[model samples]
Target: MFGGSRRVRQAALFDGASLPRKHISLGGWCGPALMLGKLGLRTEAYPFDFSRVTLDGLMHFIQNGFAEGFYPPGPPPYRPECVGPWVLFRGQHTAFAHFDLNDPRVQAHFQVKMHRFDAVLDAPERPVTFFRTVTARHPQEELALALDLEEAVARRNRSLDFRIVFMVHDQGLRASAVQLAPLSPRVSLWALRYRGLPSDTLFDRTHTAYHAVMLHSVAEENWSAVKVGVVPPPPATMASAEGWDFERNVLVCDGAARTEDVPFADLTITRFPWRSHDNLALIDGVASVGGTCTGIGSTKMLANASAALHVQRLARLKCRYCGDATYHAAGRPFRTDRPFTDEEDQLVLIHLYKILTGGDKVAAVEKLAHEMRRGTYEVICRIQYLTNSSTKLMDSFDPNSLSDP
Candidate 1:
């Protein structure tokens, strides 16, 4: 079916250019010569005028035709993908296809049907209506439509009805209504890459192809979390003057105090709550007790609580790289080029532990002063410096950039 006489007049307002048929398919030089003669564009070396042919405009034409019911079904000459459903309509700018949104078979499979109502209403005065329905073979399974078609009809101001019905073997058939929405005019064409399999032959090749699908959206936001291990210093021993020794316990942490439990080499627990502020408190310390640092056993015990909190915090953020975000946020700061020192490493562990345990701000600062062998004011200043400088650090080391397997 075609649009009404008045609607046809309105459609005439949009007179797009005719695309060259030769460009539609792959052919040798002879085909192009024949096509040029047919279209009257050939004049020995004279370039053809392509003012009307545009990817966007062509896509709009096809989408509009599909919405307006200008296309009829037949034994198509080429495969769906090769010639492309919209390619033939390139010459008939006013031609379109009527997508059966109410098709029961399609509804049964997809559950939802997205129609390009926008394309149908290109000529606002000519509106389209779509119907949908479903059926089940079992009496217990009753078919239904979720969308309100009447409301859609009134909204689109269309006279045509696109009815869809489903057939059930025993229960018979049922019908429903579907609301049609406008189709976007923008179209993007991309070259797809396909890899042939070993069993593939020229006549029957099986290939894996990858293509990107784009959608229009109003807004979007992305965030991520990193995990860092915090290992406390071991108690003072005769063998080493350092208060703690991670090598004996088999666990060593990177600068920010996120904890992790590896094999014997490291028994660190990967704790969560991946914020830089959270890790700073533990790395520095809280009050008189300074922070607790036992062997691997105690460290693991402490990490349990910290890790839980970290996970909960990450869940709250709803970040993409949840674990990595916590790790990076709690890790120790170091210039990419410089090597870390034992004292610096020990401090990192202490800071991570304190932060993980929900160490009090005032108490943690006081403990850091005692452990680092620095004054309370000095420790407080260091915490402040780290807090302020970390903003810049996170910008560069964004945990969101990391991919998850």
Candidate 2:
């Protein structure tokens, strides 16, 4: 006896923060989070590598130690809102890379030995929640995992209390129609795809009109809808718009053009100063507790934290470059290529002296550019003017100021 109507309502909440979905190869949690956000589901993503750890190893952790807050050290699993009857696991995108799941032996292994859903099926209350999706970036891979898992479940236990969902990407729905049409009644299917692609000029950009259509399809549960070609390009007026307004954190599009507003937080996380999005979310086996180095797990979380600090430093450098804080404090507009004051030159010398004395002349000029909010070319010219034996600016200033803190 399933819990009936109450279970339907609870399951629809769609809060799967605990399981933390990611494409891994794609932009990780940021893209998935954005897509889910379009559907009005707020997820605090904590991504982990689904490919590295063995399936049995993951199951063991959940079965033996999930209770008493013994969940993985990454992503602060103790958050109250993160809990739900449904648990989503990000399937390995490359599950079928080398081996075929269709092979009877492999199917048997998953059904008899692996027993992946034993914990969910054997729970105390008969759960009415649909088996939350097993997500993957590749539509073919996700569809395969869904179909095979559903088949294994049917062979052994046909009277499942909850629906098993097979999710296909919108781009993959047309090609997958024949196989999907014949799915068992207990097994449902949904079309969920990420549409946003990385933009060179901005953190991310998407076809605003196409995105609305995609959102509508998902919201209505239209699993048969297929997305074709790439997302349609934005309006022509957007191309003529002014540059990025760093102060407003938005592109200065024409008034007639629709502005695609990506939140600043999303921008930073997506454009993480780090090399890639791999380590943004806390991993189950990889991220240490509190993202520190002393924990019993991998130190990738500590490295992520360090990378976040580095991003903050970069932001500060940009602020100085744009004269944001300094000009704003003085109640003046930031002007570019203004003549440097004598005090400013002195400040530049104080910072550049350390780098120059270290025998890295090129680095000294670069460092001066960052410190003085000037271009590298200008910094180089200024350095030459200051250092020349016959220069007038070098004659008046005391060399002792270069050594001053």
Candidate 3:
């Protein structure tokens, strides 16, 4: 989904839908605004940390402008642009004020506000409200926020249907904790996990890709097609020399001879240790068709075999590397919270190696826990500390440091 033609296709699909005119980002991080800007939509930011504002404070802001003493009437924290109701219109990058749920003043103004702003405008424009938080003060903070949001929406008029997206970044919370969090009919939680190569660029790309696919599905009203198109079944494994074929060829660069198939016997395929999956797939394919560089049978058979084998290989590779792919099975019921033994640390590294070598991390961790007869949380914590390259403990320590005492 990265090529020029693929981008063009996504753009064309997006062009068909009537997107929101503006986005209202309720504090937290800049991710929502950044994503909205990429979609060519106007965004009104409330800034990060200020996203922790109480529901009452938010409702108050929508009803009235910034209340008296909401921010200091000085030049430091409160700026001219971030004052009054106009602040919402123009948008503010600074946290003018933050009201926690525990604040006595917040409890005083515990009234929900739902206005009909669209009614006043000639062209009714739908504005989406997006909020994302990486902060987790308490274990149930996300669930509480979700519940508070639901309450805010529930008390309001049903006709004023504006989309409110509350995103909570996973902070190593248990599956049970997440399951306990209730969801409204309109509210949906999307758990996007990291595949590999944890970087900002990868995150942006992954989020954008998902955004495109989601838009396409929403536009087409074919939601089920998304999973089908994205996650195809892995092809049968290539084992013996039956339907596999390997060819060594060099590209013909000349303009006239470019169309011709030029075969070069001396082409060397360098096998790298890093590309274990690719090398393994190729070896299996070669062994299946015929353990030789030369053609085994008819051109059609060879071509079909090559295409099918590659397709399967790619499918399996994608599943292994896909962040959204579910790898952990749920059969174990017991949980343990104990210190990791030296032997357990070694097993954790073994699982970590699988993840580094393009294996599904969830599956690896689950397997590690099962094999070691330990809890998944314990295994995860062990891996986290060991892989923390910033610490001297990780740098100085060796995987094979355990001696035969």
Candidate 4:
């Protein structure tokens, strides 16, 4: 019923992070996005990755926050500039655009200080090469004349010493390139954790945009009505199982726990990072959405983790009694192993979701249980616990409801 690809690692990392399985949603970016909200960063969510729906989803929450105030409120209110969507499509004009640097709107919408489309540090040895690299997306008269586009941007911004966010793929993984990128200040280079992009797009510079598949599953819902969390559809994608799993690419930005390369992790300068599942338990602020500037499905960092753990953790009260390690007690091999497959997990999720959201539907749960290969009784017991627990939690005022705290 559900389909998406997010493979897990051979071993899990539960060290230091003792988060209750219930609080974490594994697999998809949806789980990670929800996890971010749980961490109090007040995530402004975007669905369909780089599609128009993504922009619509963001605008939906932006206007919602303006109209109804952000759910799980905080002091000073949540603003768009303080938040970055889970991903962005840089090739889109409006998607990656910055208004006139001097305009009030620019400060209102974005954090960038430069007015031009490109920002570079120091003069380049090969200005034409640099021009081709940076200005591939921009068709400017000044660039055609072979002007020092980098210098012009610097002069226009009135700052020679600045930061460069030069993002690349695994092929661009030269430590020397980092030092060569910017002459002053510091350059925060983003390297994709995995290298599985299209043949021509080994390194994403200009002209990089999100594919149309970004909005494939979402069409019925009004983008404006959605919040910055998991979208509709009872069970989130395999993203929860594969895409959001902490053990996989780790959909949730469990902070810099997954960060490497630099002697010390720099939140201000690290590349696209997904953390261990337990990483978020140690953090106290909004997760840095990272620098994946394309569709949602492509990012390993935004997907990942255990199948049994995912179901038990996310199905609310109905999931409370589900035993994940029971197979060991019964002298049976573990059902799921490293490098998870989505179809089987989808069955588990479908059965559990029926319990979580449709507690009254006895036939539906039974029907799903009947369809499964084994362990039907255990599934029923767990779902019953989840339903009862969820009812109790829903009937009370809870502190966990305070998202920003």
Candidate with top TM-score is 3
lDDT string for model 1 (164-243, tens) is 11111111001010111111111111111112332232111101110011101100110011112223222222133211
What's model 3's lDDT at 140?
35
- The lDDT of model 3 is 0.31
Runs in model 4 deviating more than 4 A are 1-164, 172-177, 183-405
Local error of candidate 1 at 227, Å?
Answer: 63
Model 4 RMSD to the real structure? Answer: 23.3
TM-score (C-alpha, index-matched) for candidate 3: 0.33
Give the C-alpha lDDT of model 1.
0.22
User: For model 3, how does the per-residue alpha-carbon lDDT over 214-327 read when each residue is reduced to its tens digit?
Assistant: 343233232222331122211134221321123322222222212232222211111101111111111112210111111111011111222334421121111111121111
lDDT by candidate, in order shown: 0.22, 0.29, 0.31, 0.24
Q: What is the lDDT of residue 140 in candidate 4?
A: 20
Q: Write the per-residue lDDT of candidate 4 for residues 21-64, one digit (tens) a residue.
A: 11111111232222223333212223211111122222232223
- lDDT rank, highest first? 3, 2, 4, 1
* Candidates in order: C-alpha RMSD to true structure: 32.1, 22.3, 25.1, 23.3
Residues 42-137 of candidate 2 have per-residue lDDT tens digits of 332222111222212233233443232122212421111000110111121111111122334433554442233354444413433232222232
Please identify which of the two predictions, 1 or 2, would achieve the higher lDDT against the true structure: 2
How displaced is residue 332 in candidate 4, in Å?
42
Show model 2 residue runs off by greater than 4 Å: 1-121, 124-142, 151-160, 168-182, 190-197, 200-405
Q: Candidate 2 lDDT (Cα, whole model)? A: 0.29
